[model samples]
Target: MSKYILPVSVFGTVAGCAVLLKQYVTGGRCPSKATIHGKTVVITGANTGIGKETAEALAKRGGRIIMGCRDMEKCQAAAKEIRGKTLNSNVDAFHLDLASIKSIREFAERIKQEEKRVDILINNAGVMRCPAWKTEDGFDMQFGVNHLGHFLLTNLLLEKLKESAPSRVINVASLAHIIGKIDFEDLNWEKKKFDTKQAYCQSKLANVLFTRELAKRLQGKLRWLLH
Candidate 1:
């Protein structure tokens, strides 16, 4: 019995540790019980991953969800799934290609014209490590899609956001920013040899910095949150 007790205790401890590790890795679950019945939420890259999960969660909370993605087919499919699961028909999909300024402008214009208010904006779209690629505007893909795209979208929607004062803007950044260094001279990677990892890190760092600056500039006007 004594030997058996020791093994059981060891197993219990291991199980407890594993549970804790998983919670830490996944950032645990949201504790908020608040609901946003009529609030409007616009999420970029909502076709999959973090963005999709966020849309579903918000939809469950009764917020109107607008999902923006580069792939309309996937975005529409995801919106339908979320609507079915959450029973929230407010979920809709819109095409937004961060790699192209034209597409971004068109999406923003549509949102401003169609949506009455923008309560929350989640800048969750991002591009990670990939071979050197340029945006339609001739900028590095990682930096262009991750930072510039969100920047422009946020700015373009500022009027609507301001109208819905007491609104929130959430920018999803990464820990990779810790090792990032921005090169102003060759921001587009035109002069320097392209490094996908470094470019991704730099873009993440830009996200952090941009959020900070935006928060400062907005001061008492609005709230900006970073993740």
Candidate 2:
């Protein structure tokens, strides 16, 4: 890690820890105010972190959740936890590993067979601060998992989103992306040395670009939903 990045990360961590400490002290209600009743929410990496929390929130709001994750055991556990906490909500995991294109293809096929339509798609699976590597399809690790994986998944499931008619795709991005630019030349980090944070930012930028492009196209299709 770079010298500047280390201090910044430490500061961010400390700030997060302070906020968490304050929350515990406050004993806040954090009441459920989600708008996902009767909606089907698909959250990748739903076994942990914000993904797990999102599924829980959706469940509390009477939403049916489909978890897309690589680890079946962890996914099942997460589903059980959600059900245990919330009251008889529908929460289950589907197999998905974003590192492989074949897995992405297979996941899309499985979704087609099972679900009639997807109301909300959260492309939340990502790798952060990991060692550099290339995917089986020869893309950069973070780029492959965070950007291309979601891009392919979105394209495959687009028809379902359209069928649902009021769907939303929320790809999580971070401020780390502000310094990144699209490197069309070495997008896969083939020639240049790979940096973990840089790779993350690039993938996040890809998501931002993708979202803008897709919203432009879908605006015409979803015109009726507008008030």
Candidate 3:
């Protein structure tokens, strides 16, 4: 009985530690009771993964959610699912392809012309270690899609964001940036071999830098949401 007791206790302790570790890794839930009754939120790549989950959470809070994705069908389906789950009818989908500068511009233009205000702009879309490819504008795939696209989109929407003062810009950077170093001389990898891992890291690092610089520029006018 003593032997069995020791083994059981050890197993229970291990299980408890595993649970705690998982919670720590995934982080905790939002503690804010803030509801977005009339706020408008634009989330890129909201059709799936983290972006989709974020949209659902915001929708549950009663915010007007605009899902920007390359695939309209998927975006609409995701929006419908979110609406059904959250009971928020303001959830909708729009077209935005981060791989193309033209598409980014068009999306921003539509938002500026149609939407009265931009409450939150979430740059959640990104690509990870993928085969070397260039964007429509001939930039590295990871950098182009992850950093440059959002940079241009944010800049284009700056006026509208200012008009909707106290707005928030959220850039979803990755832990990979901790080891990233931006190569100014070979940003596009034209002078060296393409390394997918390094490319992803560089893009994430750009996100961090962009957020820091933009925050400085925004000052008291707008808020930069950091995770």
Candidate 4:
């Protein structure tokens, strides 16, 4: 037992640090018991990961969820699963390809025309550290998908969002923004060699900045959260 003491102690210390780090990073559970019955919610990239999970939670709360994804098949599957889990059939799947500006416009147009009200919009779609690729409009993929796409979509839907006052917009930003810097001069990386990691960080920074400016413009009209 004496010979094994050092190794056991080191392992225990590492485990303890990991637990603490996770708790710190995850923050804490939301304490609100608010339910959003009769509310309409739009979530981008809701077919997988955090976006899917968010849709499920909102569905449970009796919200009408619109899942916007590039792949209709995956989105439909996710919508069905969420409906089954939450026993709420208000979940609908819609196509939203953030890589294309035209697609974004069309999605926004469809939402405005069909949806009676837009109570909550969650901007959750993103690409991370992808190889150098440009969007259909020649914009950098990360910036176009993560920031500009959502930016345009949100702006287009502003009227509907305001029509349904006391609405909310949630942006799922990354902690990587802490070290991110925007290169206004080379926003699309046209002049410099592409750096995937830096591009991702810059897009995340743009997300935060865009959210801030939007919140200021909306003022007391709507609630917004960036995380």
Candidate 5:
């Protein structure tokens, strides 16, 4: 019994340490308690994962959340859940298939016509290590959905964003961008054998580069953040 106790105590200590390490590495949680009461936030791929969690967080902060997702059913369900949990009736879901340029354009147009302001745009939709598939516009699936889609959507909504002024555009990128290399000659991956992992990295790198260039262009007009 005495020997067992020591082993059990050691195991508990290791487990506790692991939890603390993970918390530190993941950056715990948002420190600011500031609420976005009247702000409007649009998040892509808000049906699940980080996107859904982000929508819920902003909703709890009193922001009007618009979830754009490829899956309408899932998006609607997520919106309902967020509204219920946060008691924010302003939460809504809209169809946004990032794989298709036409869909992106239509969604942007609707937002411009219907919404009064665009306070924040979160480009959180992304495909990681997907098959060697092509998007509706005949581009690499990962690249198209992860970068180009958000690029076009952001540009289309630029006028509304500028009109709203003091607005923000958050591009969610991964550290994988460090290893990413853009093959400018074959942007569509048509020439070389497709590597899904490399494709994803390239897309992430594109997100980082795009955000940097956009920040320089928008300068004082709009704020940009890369995560």
Candidate 6:
């Protein structure tokens, strides 16, 4: 390599490292909402992506996990994988198809019957850039699974979380949420053209709104917002 090219590459690498260091020191998050160690954490869509990775991470830190996914077999596989990787052997599987209200209700009922408390509930499931579709209840697919299902699930689990005390409810929202607005009347996409990006963004916005509303209603020694 030429001397000039070598110097330029060195400069770029140093600058990138410096920027990352600055962000780490000044802009990164602090783990402050609530501790998850030994706590019961229920994460939806725990079979893949960030959800699965997060479950593994929490398991390493000693959190008891319930992997909620659409497919029970997939959830079981994820739980097995997480168990193989972490100190937590308490991980197990459960069913949660976010598109179905009946499924959500059934899952909630089963959880209520079996578990008396839930210490951490991470609403990490989401559908992105999907074609327009409606759930059985006739709500738009993105909004139905990504927002309303979690909406009802969280509400159903509220008493347990509150009773557990100092619990955390983390809702993962995307930057897409910034550009979206809820058309309450047109939620089903009845009169409008279907756009994948719009549907995703609108649904993500609803997640944020629901999180804020829930925090407002249940703060003082009971709930926390872990974004």
Ranking the candidates on lDDT from highest down gives 1, 5, 4, 3, 6, 2
In candidate 1, which residue pairs clash?
none
Where in model 6 is the C-alpha error above 4 Å?
1-37
lDDT of 6 by residue, 97-138 (tens): 999999999988888889867988889888888877888899
**Model 6 residue pairs with clashes:** none
For candidate 3, the per-residue lDDT at 220 reads 97
Candidates in order, TM-scores: namely 0.91, 0.82, 0.92, 0.97, 0.92, 0.86
* Candidate 4 lDDT over residue span 9-126, tens digit each: 9999999999999888977676777899999999999999999999999899999999999999999999999999999999999999999999999999999999999999999999
- lDDT values of the candidates? 0.96, 0.84, 0.94, 0.95, 0.95, 0.85
Clashes of each: 0, 0, 0, 0, 0, 0
**Alpha carbon lDDT of residue 156, candidate 2?**
93
lDDT of 3 by residue, 54-155 (tens): 999999999999999999999999999999999999998999999999999999999999999999999999999998999999999999999999999999
- Candidate 5, residue 161: Cα displacement in angstroms equals 1.1
TM-score attained by model 4 = 0.97
Off by over 4 Å in 5: 1-21
Runs off by more than 4 Å, candidate 3: 1-22
lDDT of 1 by residue, 1-227 (tens): 79799899999999999999988866898999999998999999999999999999999999999999999999999999999999999999999999999999999999999999999999999999989999999999999999999999999999999999889999999989999999999998988899999999999999999999999999998899998
Cα lDDT, model 1, residue 126: 94
Error of 1 at 64 (Å): 0.7
Question: Model 4, which residues run further than 4 Å from truth?
Answer: none
lDDT of 5 by residue, 94-179 (tens): 99999999999999999999999999999999999989999998999999999999999999999999999899999999989999
Which of the predicted structures, 3 or 4, would earn the higher lDDT when compared with the native?
Answer: 4
